[model samples]
Target: MSDQNVAARTRAALDAGEGILRLAPTWVPRSFLMPGARLKLSREDLYALGTHRGGIDERWFSSTTPAANEGAPPDEGLSYVVHDGAKFTLRDAVGAHADELIGPALNAKYKRWPVYSKFFDNLGPIPHHMHQSQEQAEKIGLEGKPESYYFPPQLNWTGNNFPYTFMGLEPGTTKEQVRRCLEDWNKGDNGILDLSKAYRLKPGTGWLVPPDVLHAPGSLVTYEPQWGSDVFGMYQSLVEGRRVPWELLVKDVPKEYHQDLDYLVEQLDWEQNVDPEFKANHYLEPIVRTGSEQEGFVDKWIVYGTVAGKQVFSACELTVLPGRSVTIKDPGAYGLVVVQGSGHIGKLDVDSPNFIRFGEVTKDEVFVTHKRAGEGVTFKNTGSEPFVSLRYFGPDAHSDLPKVGDYLKVG
Candidate 1:
C-alpha cells in the first residue's frame, strides 16, 4: 500500500478506537527455556512454532520493538492493531503518528515508543545473564536494556518449579573470582552459581534490574517492564544439565573479545554487583499512589525506579472490585494486559481467556493513547471478581512516581 494510504488508515483507526487501540496478542518464543504453562497459551500449541523455535512462553504487550530471536520474522515481537480485519504493526502507526499515539513530548524526545513490557513465564530458572550496557551493546548496534520484574499473585496461583532468583554477585565476591569462573568455561558447571545468592521468590513483589546486572530469574509468571532492546550475555555455562554454548556468552561481544575473560567480566557493573545492600537497592513492593484508592478501584505503583538516573519506564497494577467502575488518568501512553476478571475499558470489552491458540486475537490487551490516558478512561468490572490489569509507561510518564530509595520505608 502507499504511504499516504497507510497514514490515513492509521489515523482513522486511532480516531475510531477513541485513542485506545485494540492490539492482537504478540507471542514470543525462547529456545533455551521451559514454558511455565501459565500464560494461558493453549497447552497443545506450546510448540506451535515447532520445538526449534522453542515454546511460546512469553506474551509481549503492546510493543513496537521486535524480538531479537535468531529466526523470527521482521514483525515477531511487534504488536499489531486489529482494525476491521486489516492489521498494521504498532511500530508503523507510531512512526506515522507519534504525536497522536505517545504524545508530542515523548515523541520529540525518543521519536518512537522506546520501551515495552511482557509476561515472561518459565518452568525453571534461567542461567545467570546480564544485558549489555549501552556502550557494550552499541559495539554491535543495539540499545541497552534495563528491566524490572513484578510477580503478580493473581496469575501465579502455583509456582511452577524453582521459585528463587540469583541476582548479582555476593558483596565480597572479587573480580578475580568471576574471571576464574570464565576461565573454567570449558569445564562443567563453571561454578558461577556458587558466587551468587538466590532470594526466595515472593508474589506481589518486584525488583529493579539495571543494565549489566547479572540475574538468574526463577520460575514464576513475571510481568516485566523494560527498555525496548534485547541484548544479553549469559554467564552460566550450564543450566539444568543442558550445555550453554559459548557462542551465547559472547554473542553480543565483538569477535576479537570473544576469548577475553577480562572483557567478559567487564560487562558487569562491579560496584553494583558486589553491593552488600543489593536488596535495599533493588527490591520492590507495591505502594499505593496518592488519591489512587478511589470509590471502586485501587491503583498501586508496581514498578517505579530510575535506570541510570532516568525514569525510563514504570508500571501500575489497577484493581476494580466486582460491579464497580472508576476513571483512571495517567500522564503518558501505556500498554494494558488484563490478568484477572472480565471488564470494560470504556466501551471495549476485555476478558481473561482460559486458553489462547496461536495466531488468535484476544481482547485482553489494549494500548491507551496519551490523549485517552490524560482525559481519563473509565474501567468497569463486569465480572464477579476483581478486575485486574497491568499497564506500563515509558520515559517520565508518571509525575508522582516513587523514587528508588522509597522501598526502604516499606516495613
Candidate 2:
C-alpha cells in the first residue's frame, strides 16, 4: 500500500476514536515451548496456526515489531488498529503519524515505537538464554532488548510445571565452568542450571532484566514490557527431555564466531552473572503512586526502574471501583490492555475477554495517542466487579519514575 493510503486510514482512525485506536490481538507461537493455556485464548484456537507451528503461547500488545520466528509471516507480531470495520497495522499508523501517535521526542530519537509489551504464558520453564547487549547487537544491525516482567495475579491462577526461575549464575561460579557446559552441549542435559540458583516466582511482583543476563523463566503468564527487539541466544543444551539445537546458541552471534567457544562464552556479562545480590538489584514490587488512590480509583506502578541508567520502559496497573470513574493524565502515549471487568476508556469500550478465538477482534486492547494522554482520558467502570487495566509506556515517559526497590520505602 502507498504512504498516502496508510496516512489517510491512520488519520481516519485517530479522528474516529478521538485519538485512541482499538487493537487486534497479535498471537505468537514458539516452536519449542508449551503453552500454559491461560492467555484467555479459546482452547479450540490454541493450535489455530496448526500444530506444526507450535501453540500460540504469546499475545503481543501495541507492537510494531514483527516476530523473528523462522518461516513466520511478515506481520506475525505486528498489531493492527481497528476502526469503522477497517484496520491497518500499527506499524503503518506509526510510520504515517509518528509525531502525533508516539510523540515528537520519541519519534525524533527512535523513528518508531521503540517499545512493546506482551503476555507470554508458558507451561514449563524456558531454557537458559540471554539477549545481546546493544554493543553486541550492533554487529548484526539490530537493537538490544532490556525487558521487565510482572506476573499478574489474575492470569496465574495455577503454576503449571515449575514455579521457580533460575536467574544469573551463582556468585562463586567460574567462567571455565560455563565454558565446560557449552563444550558438553552435544551430551544430554548440559547441566547449566546446576551452576545457578533458582528463585520461586511470585505473583503481584516483577523483575528488571537487562540484556546479556541469563535467565530460565518459570511457568507463569508474564506481562513483559521491553525494548522492541527479538534478539536472543539460548544457552541451555536441553529442556524437558527435548534437545535444543546448537544453532540456537549462536543464532545471533556473527557467522565467523559461531563455532568459537571462547567468543561465545564472552557473550555473557560476567560481573552481572556473578553478582551475589542479584535479587536486591533486579526484583520489583508494585509501588502505589502517591496521591493516586482517590474515592473511585487507584493506580500502582507495576513495572519501573532504569535499564543501563536510562528509563527505557515502565508500566502501571489501574483499578477502578465498579460504578465509578477516573481521569488520568500522562507524559506520553501508551498501549493498554484491560485485564478484568468491563469499562469505558474515553470513547472506546473496554472489557477483559474471557475466551477469544483466533482472528477475533477484542475490546480489551487499545493504543492511546500522546495527545490524548497528555490531555487526560476518563475511564469508567460499568461492570459489577472492579475494572482493572495494564498500560505500558515508552522510554522517558515518567519524570518521577520509581526505582527497583522503591516499594520498600513506601510507608
Candidate 3:
C-alpha cells in the first residue's frame, strides 16, 4: 500500500482500537549494516538491562524472614528492590537512533518503543505484608489480628501466588502442589479452581497472559514481554511466611471485578508439567491484534521463533533462511538480542554489527531501529547456520486475546 494509505489505515485502527502492534525486528534490509558491525549482549548485560533499579541488595535477602508468623515488621530495606515490570521502557533508548535509521521497519520499531520520559505512569516498590486472624494473633503472642502474609498474584490482579525462584522451580516441589494450589484458588466463584485442564505451553512456546487472569508461568526462565505497567495485587507471601488477610486485600478490588474473581480463577490450567523438556524451548502463541491495516501495523504474536509478526525476540536453535528475513510493518518501537549466530538489521548505511554474545538476549545493548510508513526492516543471518535471537516492541502491542492458539505457532 502507498505510504499515505498505510498511515491513514493505521490512524483509523488506532482510533477504533483494532490495529495489531508488531513487536519483533527479525528482518532488516541488507543495505543497513555498517562495515564490520555486529551488536551483542552478555549475561551480565542482560541482567543489567532488565534490572531497572539496580542489582538485588543482599541485606534485604538476609534480613527478611521467610516464615509467615515471624511477627517481623515490614523491612524498609526491602523497598529498594524494584521489579523489572515497571522499570524498563521504549523511550529510554531512542536517541541511539536519532537519525532516520532506515525506512519503514525503522519507523514501526520506533512507534512501539517511543522515547517518552516515563514508560509507565505508576511505578513503585512492592510492599511486603501479612494476613492475620484473631486466633493466630494470639498464638504468635500478638495483641489483636494474627498477621498472615499472602502471596502476590503472578502479574494480573488475581489472587494466587505461584512460588518461583530465579532460574527454575524450587527444589523438592511436586507438580501436584503447583496444580492443586492454582486450582484451589480458582474456585470459579471468586475462589480458585483446577486449571490443569486448560491449554499448557510447550517447549519453544510462548503465551500471553491477559490482565486480571489468575495465571502463573510456573518457576521457569522466561523472557516476559508485557505492557508498560507493574501494578499488581498479592494473595500470599512466602517471603513473609504468612497469608495476607483476604478482607484487606479484597477491599482494594472493585466489587464487580471481585464478584467474578471466582469465575476467572476457574479458568486456570492445573495439569501442567514440570520437566525441562516442557519448559526449555520457545513457545509461540497468538495474542489480540490492535491498530489498522493502513496504519501499517497489524497483528501481534506471543513469539518464540523467527517471526513475531515481523519482529524477532529469541531465536535459540532457530533458523532464518539466508537472504531472507522477517519484515516488521508495525509502527511501534522494537529491540533485538542475538542469542546465537550473527546478523545485520535495518538500512545498510546506519546498520551496526552486534558485538556482545550470550546464550540469551537482553534489552541492554540492543540495536534500536526507527522506520517510517511504507518502510520496514529485516534481519540477515550472515553465519553459515541458522541465526538465533530475541526481540521486543513497545507497549502498543499489548492485547487481550486469550490462549496462545490465537497467535501463530512456529516449531
Q: How do all models score by TM-score?
A: 0.97, 0.99, 0.37
lDDT (Cα) of model 3: 0.29
lDDT of 2: 0.93
- Total clashing pairs in model 2: 0
lDDT of 2 by residue, 1-411 (tens): 798989999999999889999999999999889899999999889999988888999999999999988879999999999888888899999999999999999999999999999999999999999999999999988888999999999899999999899999999998899999999999999999999989999999999999999999999899999999999999899999988999888888889999898988899999998899999999999998733445878899999999889999999999999899999999999999999999999988899989899999999999999999999999999999989999999999989999988989988
Task: Order candidates by lDDT, high to low.
Answer: 2, 1, 3
Q: Lowest lDDT 10-mer window, candidate 2?
A: 288-297
Stretches of model 2 off by over 4 angstroms after superposition: 290-294
Tens digits of per-residue lDDT, candidate 3, 158-181, equal: 212232212222334454554344
Task: Give per-residue lDDT, candidate 2, residue 25.
Answer: 96
For all candidates in order, the CA lDDT equals 0.90, 0.93, 0.29
Instruction: Please give the distance, in angstroms, between residue 127's alpha carbon in candidate 2 and its true position after superposition.
Output: 0.3
TM-score, cand. 1: 0.97
Q: Give candidate 1's total backbone clashes.
A: 0
Model 2, C-alpha of 24: deviation from truth (Å): 0.3
Extract clashing residue pairs from model 1. Answer: none
Compare the candidates by TM-score and give the number of the best one: 2
